[model samples]
Target: MKICVLNGSPKGNESVTMQYVRFLERANPGHTFTTENIGQRIAAIEAKEEEFKKVIAAIESADAILFATPVYFLLVPAQFKRFIELLFSHNAGSAFFGKYAASITTSIHFFDHTANEYLHAVAEDLGMRWTGSFMAKMDDLLIEMHQEELVRFGQDFLTTAQQHPAIRRTYLPITSTRPDYKSAGIPMPLDCGDKQVLILTDAAPGSNLEKMTMRLASSFGKAASLVPIDDAKMNGGCLGCCRCAFDNTCVYTDGFSEFWKETVLPADIIIFAGTVKDRYLSAEFKQVFDRSFFMGHIPAFAGKQVGFLIEGPVAQCATLQEILRAYPSLQGANLAGVVSDEDGIAMAVDELIDSLAARCLRLSKSGYVAPGGFPAVAGHKIFRDDIWAEMRAFFRADHAYYTKHGLYDFPQSDLRQRLSTTFLSLLLSIPSVRESAQKEMKKHMIEPFEKVFSESPVLKRQKKEG
Candidate 1:
């Protein structure tokens, strides 16, 4: 069977993700695999109609489609995303209809599931029979055990493709309700005080997103500075080139750096406004995320209050919601709230927007950035470990930042704790002590936190104080 591999890496065939795809090809010599570097050649694909036709022709002829890419900003690269946007804008969805599809991604395992789920949903939206996906940690392919598992995964995908088994859709189609959102006049202004409120948006002029952003800006009154970011003008997308790693300097001499410095840095509260395009935000909006890779693994929005004003059915897209929530959490920012125009009633959405404004003000005034959730905690560790170890040589800027900010906080740094652990281990070696330790394990765990409750004005007093 002929399979078209949609290579979503900016490195084209040289990508680490493609290495795994090549392994699958070598293992399964019976099937033919052809690769298209859509990520690398997105400029050509978007500019030249003939180049795009060639890609569609490949998809039309293929029995199966393989989406191979590395996860960037919890999704596909901005270039690959733009290619998908082009496919929709150019009316090329028919090429993928009824095609067997599956995705494979390589990442630090930071939000890898979000990327895989995103592709699966996109495939389903394109009328493809998305069978399954294989996710791998960046170094998983180096292990023989993982290699064997990958082989089995490839075989299972091929067998499923040949059989063309019916699969339930993971995401239902998005239907816009009252997308052309109208603000119910001016809302009661939020008292932002000394907090710097910046509303960044990529809303197209006269679009529903534009209206939503306007409403949100007005809700903040004079305290908010709304700037419609031209994130679309940024690419030539991120090329995955590590040039910026050394100094946090982007290769592209764009106005993005200035925008980051001027708009992003001073803001205490940031509200992102955009419409849902396809399964996520617009590719233009994604360009902002992809281009921001220049900052490496740094949290640019740390200690800020973030919110969203979406002009589509964002509330319904769980995967999108998770990604959205993860952005603020993983970046060390607090989520004020995400309000979408899913409600058919304009007044209801307006009320929600007003409530969102109130929420942002309250959070800002209190200077409370809520603790990071699942994505934030796990993602921090992944980046922290990688930056401290193997990735250190390449990411000098990250290393410097991490060291200065005390981010290299490996638990092994505590010599006293290590000594205590060693003593405990030796004590537990004796049979009687071991049995006693096992019996008292749960009690010992609770013992340390007892002081925290009695002394600190923390969780213990939250019920009464809060």
Candidate 2:
């Protein structure tokens, strides 16, 4: 059986994810694997019609399609994303219909689920028999256990492909019609004194996206500046070179670093405006995100408020919505809200503007940041552990930042907690003591909170004053 491998890594053959593919090929001599470096040669593929047709031809001939990529910014790299866009633009979906499909990605276990979810949805949308996904850690091939797992995964994939098993659709077809939106005029202005608000977009001139962004800014009444993503002097998408990991400097001398630091980073509230292209934002919008990889895994927009102004059927695209929500949360920014033209453009714009203004003001005043949920919490821990263990020597800047911010909150470092656990364990070794402790565990947990409420109003007031 011939399998088409869409390698979605800017590093091409050098990608760590491809090593797993090679292992699978060697382990299964019966199957033939043909690899296309789609992400690395996206520009050539887009520019040359023949090059693009070669990819479609490969898919048409293959018995199965394996999407192998490294998770970048919670999804595939911008280069790979562009290739996906080309499939839609070129009307080549028919080539992939009925093919057995699955995705494989390598990441630091940072939002890998979201990336896999995206690929699964994409395959289903293309009318493929979506089997499943194999998400590997970057170094999974090095471990004996993981090696066995990879072999099993490959065998399972081959079996599923040969049998041609029917699979349920994971995503509903997007049938939402594009609404004709006309601005109902901006509402009364709010006085956001000394607050820097930016409307960043990749919308073309005279596009509905531009109108939505303008209306949102008008609602703010502060004459916020619009920063077109195309105006940024970005050279290309991240190469996964890890050069920035050492000194926090990218290989390219593009002025994007200065623009990000001097303009984007300083904004108190940022409104991202874009039209949903294919299943995600535009390639230009993706470039803005992909280029930000120079900042490494740190939260570059911490404490900032962000809102989305989308001119598309966003409600129908659950994966894109998840990406939107997860992006801000992972960066330690509050997701003010996502407003879409599908919700009756005028009404949605007005409500979104009002919500953005209110949330920004409240957050700015209180300086309160909601704790990150599972994605950010887990992502931070993964990066923290990776940096402290293997990456410390290369990622010196991350090490310094982590040390300064006390991000190395290793659980074993708490001597009091460790000692208390040891004492409790020793006591609980006896059946009688264990029974007594189990009975009182609930009450013991409530004791700390009870003490807080037990304080007198006078004492509480004095503590507040102090």
Candidate 3:
């Protein structure tokens, strides 16, 4: 069986993700694997029609298509994303029809699920038989057990592809019509006050996206600033070169870094506007994010109130909605609101946009950023640990920032908690103490937090205690 591997890493064959591809290739001798450096050569592929056709020809001839990529900003690299866009735009999707598809990605296990979910959906949308996925932590191949598991996974994929097994779609087709939205003029206009409100969009002219973004900007009044990233003369998608890792300095001499610090980073409230292309936001929007990787794992939008003005089936795309929400959440920012023009009623969409703008302004004024949810919480820990260890050598700036900001709040450093835990463990080892502790464990669990329910005001208590 011939397998066409779509390599989505910006570093091409040299990427760590492709090493996994090499593992599979070496493990499976009978099956031939042909690799295309999609992310590396995306520019040429998009510019030259013949290059794209060559790639399509490979896909058409292959029995299976393997999507191997690194999770960049919770999805595939912007370049790989553009390849998907090109595939759909140039009517080359038919090449993938009826082919078996599977994906393998290498990341720090940071939001890998979302990335794989995106790939799985894309393959399904391309009329491919979505088979299985293998997620390898950056160094999983080094472990003996993991190495064995990887071989097993590789064999299973070929077996599955050859068997012609029935496949079921995981995602339903999105059916939404963009409403003709008109600003109803906010009943109670919000005063952005001293907040630096920034509305960023990749809205196409005469499109519903433009209308939605315009409505949002109008709701925020003159104090707000709207910038169309689509018009920005961006050099290109991020090249996975780790030059930025050393000190947050990108190799590109373009105005992108200046755009980040001067425009995006200074905003107190940022409203992202876009039209969903396919399963997610436009590749241009994704490029903004991927390029922003120059900032490393820092919280660029910390304490900001972030909102979204989308002109797509946001309600239907649960994963996209989650990705949008998680982005703000992970950045130490509050998800003020997400307004999509999913409803056919123009009035309904207008009201939603107005409400979102009002909420964003109100949150910004109060300086009230909601507590980070699971995405942020888990992501913080992931970044913290990696910055202190694996990423420290590459991202020295992150290491310095984490140390200075106390982001490396490792549990091992909590001497008091460690002592208490050790003492409790010893006590619990005794039969009598263990029995007593087990009986009261449930009651003790809530004892510390019970004051919040009974106390006059926990907020005041916290401040007073401090």
How many clashes (backbone N, Cα, C below 3 Å) per candidate?
0, 0, 0
- The C-alpha local distance difference test score for the whole of candidate 2 amounts to 0.86
Q: How does model 1 fare in lDDT?
A: 0.86
All candidates' lDDT scores?
A: 0.86, 0.86, 0.88
lDDT score of model 3?
0.88
Better of 1 and 3 by lDDT: 3
lDDT, candidate 1, at 55: 96
**lDDT digits (tens) for residues 1-466 of candidate 3:** 9999999998999999999999999999899999999999998998998999999999999999999999999999999999998887887778998888999999999999989998888888888888888998999999999899889888888998999899899988777756576656554546777778899999888888888787777787886888999545589989888799999999998889989889899998998898888789999999999999998898888899999888888887767888998999888899999888778677888888888988888888878887888888999999998778787988998888888888999999999999999998998899999898789999989888878766758677877899
Extract clashing residue pairs from model 3.
none
Residue 419 in model 2: lDDT? 100
For each candidate, what TM-score against the reference? 0.92, 0.95, 0.95
- Candidate 2's TM-score: 0.95
Models sorted by lDDT, best on top: 3, 1, 2
Model 1, residue pairs in steric clash: none
What TM-score, to 2 decimals, does candidate 1 have? 0.92
